[model samples]
Target chain A: MSQLNAAARAPLDSRAKMIEFHEVHKYYGDYHALRGISATIREGEFFSLLGPSGCGKTTLLRTIAGFEDISSGAVLIDGKDMSDVAPNKRPTNMVFQSYAIFPHLTVGENVGFGLRRDPRSKAEKAKAVEEALEMVGLKGYGARAAHALSGGQRQRVALARALILKPKVLLLDEPLSALDKKIREQMQVELIKLQREVGITFVLVTHDQEEALVMSDRIAVMFEGEIAQLADPETLYRRPNSRRVADFIGVMNFLPAQILGEAAGHVQLEVGGLGRFEVTEEQASARASGAEPVVGFRPETLTILYEGQQAHDREAPATIDEVVYYGDMTYYDVKLDGVDAPVRISMRNVFGRPVLDVGTRTRVAWSAGALVLFR
Target chain B: MKFSSLKGYAFLYLVFLYAPIVLLPVFAFNSGTIIAFPLKGFTLDWFRDLFANQTLGLALKNSLIIAVSTSILSTTLGVFAARASTRFKFPGKTGVMGLIMLPLVLPEIIIASSLLVVLLAVGMPLSLFTVILGHTLMATPYAIAVLNAAFSSLDRSLEEAAYDLGETKWSTFRLIILPLVTPGIISSALMSFTISLDEFIVAFSLAGKETTLPIYIFSQLRFPKQIPMIMALGTCLVVASIVLLATAEYFRRRGLAKTGAKDTGGFL
Candidate 1:
């Protein structure tokens, strides 16, 4: 576990860093948009900026595309400072959220718009447009009017248009937000495959956590114009460095805990519901929030031990306060003995397993390794 | 019975509004000079008289020149103002846009008098050029109103997308913004032309020797024999106005359809 922690913490040395933000700050008059953002995006990696709206995720993405000028710091693409670069001069293309398909042009003309300055012959440009259309699964759609396409098809056209230029970096600004849910899910998977095939560094800005987790190799979770945590999807989900990141990534149950003391490389803590337990240094997060210190655990970390089942770790007595029955799983709000508030637990409903009713007594099993202490 | 009376009221209101205008061409085509009740035999003599009048022809040429110049100048200025207001954020933007749009609601007499005063104070000679300047000032607010609708409805990402696809700012505006807003430009030009052509107060206040059609028609109203020719000219203007307004409305509707935007009510 310590080796995995060190491995995750160490600087990435294998792959080339394709983009870097060095203390980049952006201000819109009196409003500070991006605050000292510094990170390295690796080559050919699917990176995402995940945050709530107005958290500067889109601002950071625009800085790379040169659509927005940073007020203070430098944005380096391929290790070159891009302070004076114009958007058209930058080696980046963006798939805008609105798709921005030129309504006046046909699909072919829209895709070939970037090649106007190229010295290629007419037939070659036409063939290039055809190949780009086919790459985005929109074959034979070149002659169609751009405005006549459906929402998803317009998105595919936007992708083809941006990718036709073969830019070094592809920036996507909430590209799937305009699509319906079913299509959005499908396009998320397709975007990942497309990124792999193109081998260009992709920077995606999205507010949806599930989309970020599903499509990105690493995510920088931002809040209030600053990145709260930058890690892989697994680390971001399991060991979120801050309480806000833990709450943003997924569902986590936080219970107040009293920090007893710190010993040699370990911290002893007393949890409200599960009594005293010693947590390792890596399991603890040093966020000095003014509120009370708490211990957080994912819903799946706590389990309901049924009859004839033995716990792999410690067991606590609890009563099922509420039951929410999903098709494949059942969620229970279980209140442990002497704990005032109920903590949520998710149990899978395999065949022949009866769901426990509300107000029923049960034994809840949890492991100390899965707990994250917030101080 | 109440609903029937209300419908009758609406019918009577429309007839009251259109009755005088409908009579203009009726007398214009009448052979008899007296414009009273009884219908006279139809003749092409009054239309023939309008062509032989040299001063009226000169006035017509002057109005055309002033209208065309005003339309181009006002619409060009409208495009700049509308683009700036919609696509950017500057200090005191609302105040700047409000001042530019003030001519729409300002009384035409006040605008004419102030412009005449300013021009004479600056020692500028009053000619068709001064009248064109005055007409452009009067018509630009309307041009901006129509053009604001054009530019504000445009998705800003379209320009960014063009820039992202390796096009410079000038090419993006030329290829994308110019084509998309062509209908708005046409609509604004037509509106300004119509307004400038029929404008009497500014032309009267600004034009020293270059008499516009309206002023010439007003001066000729004193001669009873020239009344029929003036009515004939009014008939032509009425038809031309309807055609111009219809064409403008068509372009506006086509613009809405091309952009796939929801149709709010238009000028027509």
Candidate 2:
């Protein structure tokens, strides 16, 4: 965790660019698949392209692997032009979504397939294959038929096969989408650990927001063939640049607000139910949705006040409209005294505390610093 | 009791289909020259006569040559057509594939007559080569049908993965694709060989001088002395067909098992 944090905190200028897409655009006949995508993936960083399906995240990743040609602009890898290079000639490898292990080959043969052109001796290549299998926790599984392995095992074999080549960049296209929930989570952690151990630049494409947050050092959230926002996970979750981005990343409650004025470094706003408050300019996203101004805050940021509990920054009186009980937390849809619609508030279930029921009058604690003003 | 009538119908259907084949071996071993039901003492004279016939031997050679050439040519053409149809999209793709597969539905006599006219108009000599050409035209559509199933069932990502893992397109096809589809290729070749061996109309229409096995069998049907020898030959063909079909099914099942793919119906 410390190592991951340190990597995340490292300054952008400290690392060299591994992949650079300069205004890359791709068109499939009349349909625009990638629209002027321009981003640089730094060396050894665990980067992710995240969005819902058909957002062209996978298409952008394929441009790096030379599987798809861009309509215009350039994609450079390691400071060199890669437009003319074929997938086999490029210094990158991919773990396909289907985990395309060769059904006719054994596990070891599949892992060692890329070494056919290498100048190493047969015994040395065999040793390398064994080591690669062991690295993915599949020791002594080299001789087994690849088709007989389980889904998780096939994923491991694919990883070992790609990693054995020691390419400059590793591309993964929703590699965990096929596995069940439990195995998917386990593989996510294992992938992070593997990425850190190798220190190779890993570019992952996924639609799962939580998986991206838990695995990526920095994420590029895309929508409609365009990147909406690119930032660290914390920044993306806390300060999404647009309402659409905010809604896509996680649950954020939006309430109507009137922007009074801007003075000094703070913008004062009259929130419909929470009353007037001032927030810094950094808390306001500059891109407007052309809709009315609204104040957005996460569910966990609002806490339902208990008996004798003091409000930290500010307080609002509300009536519980609904209650959803989870083992670790309880979510309440509370209608503020003056607001027409209910906003969800999530509260941790502490020991010996009674579960609140619907229709109960309560006071909810909130802070102005936790809110984001979206124009 | 509800299914008793259905069971009897099925039994009758099977016997109707197989009873003639059973009669082939029964008459083959009977000593009587007449094909009537009264059985004489067992004798191998008809089998000896079948082996000693030189015209039959020549016809068998010609048929083998045609069948082997037809199988190789048709299967090679099938691979190209199947790969093209499955892995690409171009203008008139459906129409083009439909035209290529049109021979499967066209009557063999029509094909034979049209091909005979075309060959004569072009001043091409009719021989075993002509017979092979006609048989390949008739058999390629079936080959492609079998190969299309094999190629389409294959996941496209498998090829991409091989190419991504430092393999050129040709090498990937050779090392990854060829082995996976070997059973389909075998099935296709056997199908073409069987079609060519038993085909009569095209061979009769195109072969000006050379005679294939089917033409020989048809010619021998008029003579009473050669009837038992034809039965002996028929017995050999039946056994050969069973062995061939069983071998193909074995390979097909093995391929399916190797790939962990579900067995979706096969020749067996």
lDDT of 2 at B121: 99
Query: Residue by residue across B111-219, what tens digits does model 2's lDDT show?
Result: 9999999999999999999999999999999999999998998889899889999999999999998888888898899999999999999999999988999999999
DockQ of structure 2: 0.83
The predictions' CA RMSDs to the true structure, in order, are: 3.1, 1.5
lDDT of 1 by residue, A75-193 (tens): 99998999998999899999998999999888999999999988999999999999999999999999988898999999999999999999989999999999999999989878887
> TM-score for each prediction?
0.95, 0.98
Error of 2 at B80 (Å): 0.7
Clashing pairs in 2: none
Per-residue alpha-carbon lDDT of candidate 2 for residues A152-218, written as tens digits (9 for 90 to 100) = 9999999999999999999999999999999999998899889988888999999999888989888
Question: Which residue pairs show collisions in model 1?
Answer: none
- Top candidate (lDDT): 2
* Each model's DockQ score: 0.70, 0.83
Relative to the true structure, how large is the alpha-carbon lDDT of every model?
Answer: 0.90, 0.93
